[model samples]
Target: MGRQWRDGRGKLVVRGESGDVTLPLEIASSLRARRRGLLGRDFVEGALLLSPANSVHTFGMRIPIDVAYLDRRLRVISVRTMKPGRLGLPRLRARHVLEAEAGAMEGWRVRSGALVEVDTDGGSDAHDRPDSAGTPSLPS
Candidate 1:
């Protein structure tokens, strides 16, 4: 069987004004993976990429997180820091959701309008075109 998007375990490179920020990313595309989310994790070193998601909730979380809603073009639509027990409103234009530690988004300059790239092959360079594996660059 082909590798599923849900099985994605790679690095995410956010090319921002400050420079390039590289971090690990766990992609949640499958129903089961999406449902589980980061519920049990006390801390996340990198971030989680939830495909086909427009909303998220931290109902049972232990810490706050920074969430970025991205449109189909991979352009960030909005960014917010949410605390535990809070339910995020759905974004009509969001095709994906990116979640990371509180304040991490700022450090990475991952605000609205910024683009995100993913390297599933453990590469160091960030490409605006499709990845070497032929996966179209993150929605864009």
Candidate 2:
């Protein structure tokens, strides 16, 4: 659930639910979040932005993280672990990127087809109402 960037032959250790993986950094660079609303947060731990067919490098992180590779259309193509201070090789068709706490994806059931919904409005819908028993109703 953390990230580590690499400079050379560094080791990345990701502690998973059942086990762990220590791998080398394929590509290394400074990772920053570009989403609209994440600016004020103290720090972004597990997040990524993939370019179209480019490389990702990690050289200055302290923890391990999970990386999700997305295609140009923002569809997840693959996922893997990147240890601290390593590099991720270029994926020819990669477009978007997502990083998360190690093993969090599996814990949250996040998969290729799972949709990521960004709420830009920052407001709740008026139609969101409670049912007869005071239970919230689902969106139509």
Candidate 3:
């Protein structure tokens, strides 16, 4: 398997019409980390990035979250807010998934066709090869 995410630690800068929005990045490139997700988190300061993920579920989560589906070029495909115990559909074109606190996407201007740029801070990249071995299927 390729290098796993540096424990989902980094930073991201989303270019907005008014200004750039920066947030803490939590990358999930490993099967284990991807499976764990934000299950027990009550609040998220920034966002969680799941590389090679097409869908997500908030089965055991404590708080609602905003989901952003991005294509290979980091362009947003769609943005939706999912409450706890919800499942998101898989986007065929999505190469990565970004999750944040509820209503965070609107504040950051994350929407369809918007380009998201990842600002690397010495951690695994969104394009890094995701670990496939024993990777469980994500909810759709």
Error of 2 at 54 (Å): 4.5
Query: Candidate 3 lDDT, tens digit per residue, 1-140?
Result: 22223554777777677887777888887888888888898888788888878899999989999999987667789999999999899999887899999998898888897867665555434453222342222222
Instruction: Pick the TM-score winner.
Output: 1
Residue pairs with colliding backbones in model 3 are 8-27
Candidates' C-alpha lDDT: 0.80, 0.43, 0.77
Backbone clashes in model 3: 1
How much is the lDDT of residue 126 in candidate 3?
42
TM-score of 2: 0.48
Ranked by TM-score, top first: 1, 3, 2
Identify the runs in model 1 with alpha carbons over 4 angstroms from their true place: 1-4, 124-140
Model 2, 5-98: lDDT tens digits are 2222222233345554433322223343322212233344434333223444455655556666655433456777777667877666555455
Rank candidates by lDDT, best first. Answer: 1, 3, 2
TM-score of each: 0.83, 0.48, 0.80
